[model samples]
Every structure is written in structure tokens, then in C-alpha cells.
Target: MSSKINAALGREIRDSLREMRIQLSTLNHRVGSRLGLKDADLDCLDLINRAGPISPGALARRAGLHPATVTGILDRLERGGWVARERDPADRRAVVVRPVQERAADVLHLYAGMNRGIARICADYDEAELRVVADFLRRTAEAGRQATEEL
Candidate 1:
């Protein structure tokens, strides 16, 4: 493809990705509200679950939240039975946050429709095409993380 065409495609893809992110965030807010949790709390739970038993400080750093704010988020999550704080084995004085497995499925239920759609779309791609799509998504996700860090 010509460089001009490639550049235009890139711009279009970036804009679409931005809009998709905004829509996803809006969906998450609605789901969070339905679950009786703030969007930030669900975001915190997601970060904690992905990290798999992370230090409060580390979670706060990744979430771009203050320690005090993280504390409040954790408090609410714990009270809702969505997460728990366990003393870090490596550092007895420190606590690590983890998701409650039972409640995790409830969160996943909110994304079931999207997940099914994504799976159906992926079914149209062969192995090689799927690999390309996966690679593109991984690189795009990294770019998003970099952009978030910059902000």
C-alpha cells in the first residue's frame, strides 16, 4: 500500500479505537452502577484481579490513584465482597489486594454479550489472520498504556 494510504488507515484506526474505548468506559460505568459500585471501584478490582495479589501501593500506581483514594476503593470493594486484602507473605507488614473468585464470575457476566460477539468475529479469521489481529491488538494496547502514562 502507498505511504499516504497507510497513514490514513492508521489515523482512522486510532480514531476508531479511541471511540471504542470511550464506549467501553461508558458501558463499564453502567455495569458498575448496577453492581452498586463506583466506576473507580470496578476499575480498581480489574487492576487488582489482573495483577493477581498486588500491593496497595502498586495498585495505586497502576490505577493512577492516590494511596488514600486506593484505601477508600479497597474499603468499598472489601465491604461489597468483591475483593480481599491479605498480608503479603514476602512483607508481613504490607497487604496485597486480590479479587474474590466467586464474585469475579458476576463481573464477567456483564461482558458476556461482548465476549460472544468477539468470539464470533474471531471465528471468521484463520490462524494466521488471527495471529496478525492479536499482534495488532497487543501493540495497540501497549501504545494505549504508554499514552496513559504520558498523561
Candidate 2:
């Protein structure tokens, strides 16, 4: 009986996660449109911003995109003034991509509403409960990364 209850709870959690993913994807799409970026372009930009300065090859690997595709996205982003390509200090011959801080600020501004909403929701949870929620989200994200690698 306990095993059955656990399985049911697991399924419920998975379903909820799927719904959240869909909503987030939709939000990203809207944000990308506002920024005059394609979904792929915005996704690559987000990765670059989070990873800090990264080589094009490394960005391609992290984004799971072909090198040529990454090159095109970088070209578009560069032209849009969203990112800058500069020489990697460690390897003078290599190039690294970095987000234009001013542009990143614009992106963050668009997300302000969502961030506030999440903060309000988090306020309802105590530290212990929030810690459990954070742990679950972190593990779930890791599982997703593993699954993507497997694919």
C-alpha cells in the first residue's frame, strides 16, 4: 500500500514538472520575441550569460548545438549588440563569447515580473520547506541534464 502511494505521488510530481516546463517555455518564447531573438538565439545567449566567457566550441557543446549553428547564432547576437566576441586572455589565439552587460540588463528587466511572482510564492514557505523544494528542483534539473546527454 505504501509503495502504491509513493508511485502515485511520483507521477503527480512528474506531471506538475511537465506543466511547469511548458509554461516556462512559453514565457521564454514571449521574452525572445520582445528581444527580437529567435528561441535558439535566446537559449544560446542565456547559456553564454550563465557560463560567463566561453569559447564558441564550448558553447556549442553546452547548448547541444552544432558548431556551425552556434557560429550563426553568435553572428546574429553580435550584430544585435547582445554579445561580444573577444580574445580569450588565457589563450590569446582563442575567442570567447560574453554577454553585453547592458543588453543582459534589458533581458532581466523583462523577467522582473516573473521573479517577483516567484518571490512572493517562496515567502509562504519556511526555510526547512524551501530547502526541501530547492533540493528536489536541483536533483530534477540534474536528472534532466543526464537524460539530455543520454539522448
Candidate 3:
């Protein structure tokens, strides 16, 4: 691609990413409300679910929240029956947070529509194209993490 074309493509990609972020934030807000969770609490829950048995400190760092804030979120989540804090088997002194499997289905149900839409969108692309898109998304996510850390 020519430099001019590449520049235009970059601009378009940036705009598309911004729009996607806004839409995802809105969706998260709705989901969080339905689950009786604050947006930050829901985000922490997601990080915990995906990371599987993570320490409070690790979750705070991953979620870009302070340790105290994470503790508060954990308290709410526990009271809401969304997650559990258990002693780490490897290190009895430490604690690890895990999602309560029984409630996982509720969260999944809320996101099912979006997941199906994403799957349908992916169906339009060939394997190679899908690979390219996946690679781009991974790189972009890493870039976002780095940017967040820098702030």
C-alpha cells in the first residue's frame, strides 16, 4: 500500500476503534445495571472470570484500579453472589478471586446476542482474512494495555 493509502487506512481504523469502544461501553453499562453492579465492578468481575482465580492485587493492576478500590468492588461482588474469594492453595496466606460458576450463565446470557453478532460478522471473512483481523485486534489490545500503563 502507498503511504497515502496507509495513512487513510490508519485514520479509518482509529475512528472505527473509537466507535466500537463507545458502543461496548454502552452495552457494558446496560449489562452492569441488569446485574446490579457498578460498571467498574462488572469490569473487575470480567477480568476475574477470564483470568481464573486471580489475586486481588493482580486484578487491580489488570483492571487499572487501586487496591482499595478493588477491595470495595470485591466486597460488592461477593455480596451479590457473583464471585468468591478463596485462600490460594499454593500460598495459604494469599487470596484468589474466582467467579461463582452458577452465576456465570446470567452474564453469558446478557452477552449472547453480541457474541452471535460477532460470530456472524466473522462468518463473512475467509480464514486468512480472519487471521489478519485477529492479529490486528491482538496487537491493538496490547497497544491499549501499554498506553494504559503509561498513563
Candidate 3 wrong stretches, greater than 4 Å: none
Best by TM-score: 3
Query: What tens digits encode model 3's per-residue C-alpha lDDT throughout 1-151?
Result: 8999999999999999999999999999999999899999999999989997999999998999999999999999999999999999999999999999999999999999999999999999999999999999999999999999888
- How big is the RMSD of model 2? 1.0
Model 2, 1-151: lDDT tens per residue? 6999999999999999999999999999999999999999999999999997999999999999999999999999999999999999999999999999988888999899999999999999999999999999999999998999999
TM-score, cand. 2: 0.97
lDDT of each: 0.92, 0.95, 0.96
Candidate 1: 10-residue stretch with minimal lDDT: 104-113
Candidate 3: RMSD to truth: 0.7
Tens digits of lDDT, candidate 1, 1-151? 9999999999999899999899899989988988999999989999988997999999999989999999999999999999989999998998988889999888899888889989999999999999999999999889888999999
Please, what is the TM-score per model? 0.94, 0.97, 0.98
| Better model by lDDT: candidate 1 vs candidate 2 | 2
